[model samples]
Target: MNTTPLVQGYEVVIGFETHAQLCTRSKIFSRASTAFGAAPNTQACAVDLALPGTLPVMNHQAVVCAIRLGLALGARIAPVSVFARKNYFYPDLPKGYQISQFELPVVQGGVVEFFLGNEKKSVRLVRAHLEEDAGKSLHEDFFGQSGIDLNRAGTPLLEIVTEPDMRSSEEAVAYARELHKIVTWIGICDGNMQEGSFRCDANVSVRQPGQALGTRREIKNLNSFKFMQQAIDYEIRWQIAQIEDGHPIRQATVLFDPDSGETRAMRTKEDAADYRYFPDPDLPPLYISDQMVQEQRALMVELPRSMAARFVAQYGLPEYDAATLTQSQAMAAYFEAVAGGCGQPKLASNWIMGEFSRRLNADGIGVAQAPVAPAQLAALIARICDATISNNAARQVFDALWADPAGEVDAIIDAKGLRQMNDSSALEQIIDAVLAANADHVAQLRAGKDKAFHALVGQVMKASKGQANPQQARDLLRVKLQ
Candidate 1:
């Protein structure tokens, strides 16, 4: 837990409630399509619109998504879970209630672990329940009246609730990012925050160390990480200032205005009892068989943590390098292929983390979209390792390779004349010629000025037109000095 305050005299406590829209093709309780950007109310069907004589039916895929999440987080998957109707009145909710899991959620009690700088932090999860999203209220395109968009109505969503274990916004963002990776990695959710595929709600409070928990206000619909952090920091400062001025901190729901960089109250926060949650009469209890869990387990891919550990143990990589490389599956696979192809794990790690990553970020693309192939990278590393090219020449070759991805690696080096001059006799001749011209430097080197020797090496490099093997030239210079 990060208990230290960004400002003095108060501790900021935070918890997150994230809603991840499942990747299923249909809504949770209806056959309506779950696609985005459709015309309003076009996708909503009879069940989604709560038409007369309609009863809710469970989508088995949503249940599988919840189960996969539980297994991924190491949570307890309830064999049988009840669905309930959370009574609430809003213009967007056609049924005036949301079908959700309340008392017996599908997943219970897990921890999400991630790194904040060098510190490893774990945030405990209270529960993750399956629910259906309500329609959208559009306040645009109508004069003095709002329109409702039912396209997103009844979309399958997994609402993940966390314990109030985060003490800072950074920690909360880390947890959200880690959870996003897990959901996307397992093919459950798209994890696109911009399109409302993944949404976050942060509950923020402040108190002195060892003091009783303070009243928390829930910041709703934080769709981006940057906005989430800004909202939490602003809310924490606001609450502390209120307390300092002897005003009570009221619990309410607030929204973050990205333009203003501030939070404003929307409504008073409601306790669970205020919602009147009870088992839905239409939907029966959700039951999961052991066989179904095993089936999903068989379909599960190797997780990032497990793959990172394998990278460390098998390739002799540092923990940090391994962890960084395994941020995405494509990057990890590319790294392994490059390392194995060249039989140089350390060099492969360096290039991937440094030049390749820099280029990826510059191009605003992921590793999967990288232009350079693993074999090409391996060949480039081989040249550098065998002294066929200097590090500078290797970078030139990398640029050439990236510019012309289909171009041959050796052809590029040969065409540019970037190969290092490795002939020992030729290098020694160059060194001797430079030494003969710079007698003062030689005398200064013999008189114990190490810098003069470096000056002589620079002359050798210049004479050879930057192609002289640096180590070979240095060795010849040292021998002549001796």
Candidate 2:
């Protein structure tokens, strides 16, 4: 088994606290818009501004979104849960206290399964609860003061906490990506890292196999997968180094510097006592009924694991290809669309994974924004399979189709006169011309030089203007040589 020295005599235990912003039109307690990038405080309302006499009104949409997520994670929705006030003093928190769940949360006890390398591993989830997000403090203009943006304040957030199950940074990142996919697939969250819809806080600690847990450090505000991996890797090594040097690990919050590629301590970790969490008197305890849970469960879609299996069994795709294609819902739908007709599954996968993905990356487009439509790509692949056009000609047609989605594949073939020269008589003429031109290669083929056959195929393809089907051209060349 591949193992890390950091966990050689010790077990590296990890848990994640992921905050996913709900896809709601307004803030959790106010009618203020929750849209991103609105000139800082333009989306803020009087309630979000923490004006006097403004009482918090819970958003039902936020509660439903949280319940949907809990059902998707296979968690138990509590009959009644209370929102507690987590008191803290920060410029971003205008209310001087943030509304969150303590002691009793809305949902509890679930598990998420993901693959580590080729092995399937399961991570237990402790709880997932509803909370309001704090505003952002922009430090861009440091004239000795920071700008406060309450646009994000009071936004509905679902804090999903996992049990200490991950061992390496790779596993942690994979788990996070899977969770991201689930949320986005269900339409609960947009999963936009750049806009901070989904944020991760990782708790990392190392312990001897049979010993108690070590001091765990919280790495906060990790937005991207690459940064998460790097930050955890660096933290693991730093902790290992500290233990090796006779220094004890400190429990604190740390921030990762992408440029420095290291994590630095931000503040001492706060205990529950520090937050002084207490049930809010303004709002009553939230309740979930069985009918509500059943309704949410009915809306859940087939998850990645189930879809992966279907891709393998029904589509006859390889395990890796199925896993990759099913990673994103858009990609999976695109694949199904392309493979809808009588197209060969393996060939469809090759074209989609190879040429399709290449073009997407080259053009800086996501699958959702791909210029080439599924039917257009499928028609192009059909033309190649039926020998109406060579693979190279089909690729050229695909490029044109990508540029112009309304452009028809058959129209492009007819317009460019790119049809494959598959007629036996026509191919024989080109084969004879090529053989006559390269007399030496023909001689080599007769002298048991099998490699010379490839040279002849190239010459014939060149003579036919790359229209001849390569396999047919080779067969015709072999017949003529014999």
Candidate 3:
């Protein structure tokens, strides 16, 4: 609910409609293969093409996907929901309409909670209805006319719609990412934006504070988060420019062109009336017994939020850290194993989120594919905890281990001569010699210039060649200065 204006004096209000393709083996109403990259129309069944003597039968797995989503979002699952034909004409739609839930949907009234930076954000759900996908019109392969790919036709999709709760483009992106994680975590959808497994439609508008909501234009089919933010920001500026110029904002659907970094009007935005939605005469009501809901719930994996909460309670991590670590199951598992092995959750968290993730992003890989194993990382952290190595030395060890993942932590440290000098007697001699040589530094410290103490410590570090434990050196140096 951060209503602060991102730019200009208008408060930007945005809502999202995301269609997450379900992880079903078959289409929503047809037995067509729900696979990607098939030859155009090869995977389409007779029902998918709306051929003669064909009648739509609901895919039971699609209903299960809807149920799983409802449970994950804490939404209400309707025991009885009706499917309707949404009349719309498109070259890709063979039936000239889409079968979707209208008056009643399977899932209702849920909230998606996430963090925009450290601030918590929650978007209220209007409804998440079960629907069938349309085919794709290919214009690249054909010159004069567009070709249709019915392979994607009748594919199962869960259209998750949100209330107008987001106030900024950043918040909208955060919400979309959180929704993506939830769907993928629950194993309901693959959550692939590039392949169109997950697609987002952003409804963006702006208004003066305490004024009636302004006319909103829908930005359709945003696949990239970076591009989504760019589009929303541009749209906000464009709409404000229109209003300030004394022009009315027309409601329309727009597409973001990544090449131009701009949004162009695709068509006038269609309202519910334009669709002419009605009950499908061919299909019966969708009934989900309470038992069905419980069954899906039983099979559902431990959700990201639940695991994050556990991280906070069990490992004494901050809410932010817990949420970040639990962004994926593999990262969470890696963290737990390292924390359990080293008995240092905070350090483990820092290494994983900081260095580990940096490397992962740099190498374009994931935690599961990371070269460093959990045991190896845990052993590295243990060295730091036991004063066997300094943080700098540990980082060096990590680098060596990254190069050769099978390399042991202690072996690398010993081989590279990265072990810290922790012996108090040896450090005391070095401290005494530095103190004697830098009597001017002592005089400066006596005069209350705190930096002179660090100069003295630097002399000791130089004398010890960075082998001295810095913290222990500071402690011993403090006593000698007193």
What's each prediction's TM-score? 0.95, 0.91, 0.97
lDDT for model 3: 0.93
Report the C-alpha displacement of residue 208, candidate 1, in angstroms.
0.9
Off by over 4 Å in 2: 1-11, 49-53, 115-121, 207-211, 442-449
RMSD per model, one decimal: 2.0, 2.7, 1.6
Flag regions of model 1 displaced more than 4 Å.
1-6, 141-144, 439-449
lDDT of 2 by residue, 405-447 (tens): 8899899998888999879999898888888899999888889
The 0-to-1 C-alpha lDDT of every candidate, in the order given, reads 0.91, 0.88, 0.93
User: Among all windows of ten consecutive residues in candidate 2, which has the lowest summed lDDT?
Assistant: 1-10
* Higher-ranked by TM-score: 2 or 3: 3
> In candidate 3, where is summed lDDT lowest over 10 consecutive residues?
1-10
lDDT of 3 by residue, 170-234 (tens): 99999999999999988889998999999999999999988999899999999989999999999
**lDDT score of residue 90 within candidate 2:** 95
What would the per-residue lDDT of candidate 1 be over residues 190-306, giving only the tens digit for each residue? 898999999999999999887898999999999988998999989988998999999999999999999999999999999999999999999989999999999999999998778
The numbered model that scores best in lDDT is 3
Deviation of model 3 at 107, angstroms: 0.8
